[model samples]
Target: MPQHTPDHPTRQILTLDTGVDAVEPGPDQRWSTWPSIAKGQRGPHPHPDWVVTAAAALDTELGVLKTGKEADVFLVERAVPDDPDRAVLLAAKRYRDTDHRQFHRAGTYTEGRRERRSRDQRATQDRHSAWGRSVRATQWADAEFATLCALWEAGAPVPYPVQIDGTELLLEFVGHVDDAGAAVAAPRLAQTRPDTDLLADWFEQVRSAMGVLARLGWAHGDLSPYNVLADGERLVVIDLPQVVDLVANPFGAELLHRDCRNMGAWFAARGLEVDVDALFAEVFAQAW
Candidate 1:
């Protein structure tokens, strides 16, 4: 029989008979009651510390953050045992159930992406097969993780990708903790209505961020206010699994044009005099 710990109500502790050794949970175990968060990591950037290491440990699931047609985003917390300060909260996006995903749009979005193997390419195309579903899940996860890293390094407003495990992706959480110790995700730009000054400032940030992407010869395939999170004075872009390649994909130019129009219209609707043509021209000039 197992008993619950007082501090960790959800954890169960098992006691063995006398003269027998008790087996405690190790780093490899992902127990429901394990404490998340480590020590000495109270810095601004709280990314995962163990990505390429085999000595990495399992993390605790906090809760589900959001759901989409292709994936469900959950909150995960990982920390070194007995070290609370080094703990970090991450957005764990799990890609599952390809049948429920809107993969019909995959062909157009993945035009520029190169598959490492023919099997994977075949599997991705055949979404009805088991191997196909598995490959699609991993492919999307890998694409999102890679895009996040690239955009972050390129100084674009996006989340920092920490690690990718099969169909799951660990990314930086783009929200702040409230005064009551509750985690609050930053509202999407669509959910916000800023004043004149703040709105103008936000537009500038959005334009600059988009410029960064254009300079990298990429375009967010799905650019809208709903996927952009407003974190105080900054804007963090999300959902990059469908990022477009400006050179390889024939529809790349169209995607960039659409993105510029979408964002420009958004700002214009708010009474901001934004030049969509100029923005598109600038991006096109920078694209190779």
Candidate 2:
């Protein structure tokens, strides 16, 4: 007989007894969603070694890591039963459906973006419809996932996008395990109090990351210290659903300037002697 879980409405789990007893999933766990979604929904080719693709794996919801205007991030652990070595933690960022999301400035960020299908375009405009809300939710998730994939491939310091199912995006957890064996999320760059040498190193990493985006003709539309994670000495830029195409978006240059100013001011406040104008000029030059 097959058993159904409330969380996963699409799949049915069959608890078949084969000489060895089947391990029934616990209340907080469900079968890994890898085999259910199409391969195209998965991460880029040559998947990272830590990504568990086994059908037998279970995904356990750990807890909420963050909440924002558009989405909420939760900690998830995926592992095969009885295989401790195959376990890995992932940050599951689930974009809220239209009804729940409070992103009032979406239009500002999506100025030059277009829906591929005419129907989708129409639905996105008709926010009152259920279909419209669903489309809007997935749009942000898809955008962020695609952006992370591109940035990671271009050698930027960003989390590896694992996969996206509907509006939920799974990414490589950019944190370390604590002494108690519990995963501790990396502190945001704004929360860190780095010394002189470390501050300079952090600034250099941010400069290099911004350079990469410039080369790609894109800008982290709302970049700030709050959205960057400080994992040891490495800085990982996040919350990139609003990445602007330098040549396409009307406010691209303005957004780029703001990004430079935002990060520059933070560094300067710490006595780093950052020149916002020079930083913007250096990045803007590479955009061409």
Candidate 3:
């Protein structure tokens, strides 16, 4: 998610990759919109140490199920801390080493959630310096961790954060014992339709996940194709690194609503129809 610079780097690839649906890169340069905001995270490398620690904790484990952002996910069998014989398959999320420049503008999502009145006050101030960046990076990782834990507690469809072992975080793996290798590429509500009953069940999971978010007063800010993995019976949401601010993110409702819409569209593609507007209306009805 690089910034919307005219010629910095990935801009060319994105232009070539998604020319039609692409929102023309803005020229404001004030760090107000998506590209400028996304620019802070310019690489796939983990911009935080927690991510690296997360990876190191799960490396070289047999049967590691891979799926995630910032950190690589592995499905590994390890003995439970309390019971040595009770080995379990855990999905280990490890953060890769990402540069600090990737998070200079992240204050926009965090500050708004804690502020009293204004959001622009601390949106993108001088936080890219040595000390400021270090603090901001921690805040960024913590925020994502909060959302992941929140989703886990709310019974949303995602892996639970088992333990934050320094940089490595562990959770119950999604696939079953036999189907571990069947897990395909990241699957979002935007892609794939297995069958009627299966697609219907997935719709329920997606909707139910959104319901959990609304009940908890949060949004899956980064809901999209790249953040999901389709294992036989479930739609597991990944990528929590950039989940938006429920308050400051001008697109919170729209983001959540679009999540519902995306799921609805996916269902429709599979001959299952749903009223996208009604779904959105119902989920955020209490909020508005």
Local distance difference test scores for all models: 0.70, 0.84, 0.51
- Residues 1-288 of candidate 2 have per-residue lDDT tens digits of 753211201111121111221387777778889899988788866677678899888888888999999999998888877666567888999998888888888887788888889899999999699889889989999889888888877778888788989999998887877666677889999999999999999999999999999998899999999999998888989999999988888999999999999999999999899989999999989999
For model 1, residues 108-181, the per-residue Cα lDDT tens digits are 88897888898888787784889887887778877887777667656577776666666777777777666665
Q: Which stretches of candidate 1 lie over 4 Å from their true place?
A: 1-58
What are the TM-scores, per candidate, against the unseen true structure? 0.79, 0.91, 0.61
Candidate order by decreasing lDDT: 2, 1, 3
**TM-score of model 3 relative to the true fold?**
0.61
lDDT of 3 by residue, 1-288 (tens): 954221111100000111112123222111111122232232222221122121111122444455443456665443322232233444656655446233334434443465222332243244455644344434445556567766664556775554554345555455443344332334444556577888777778777767777777666765664466686566788767666655566767777777777667667767988999998887776454
TM-score attained by model 1: 0.79
Model 2: weakest 10-residue lDDT segment is 8-17
**Model 1: ten consecutive residues of lowest lDDT:** 8-17
Q: Which model, 1 or 2, shows the larger TM-score?
A: 2
Segments of candidate 3 deviating more than 4 angstroms: 1-69, 80-84, 97-111, 115-128, 179-192
Candidate 1 residue-wise lDDT at 185 = 82
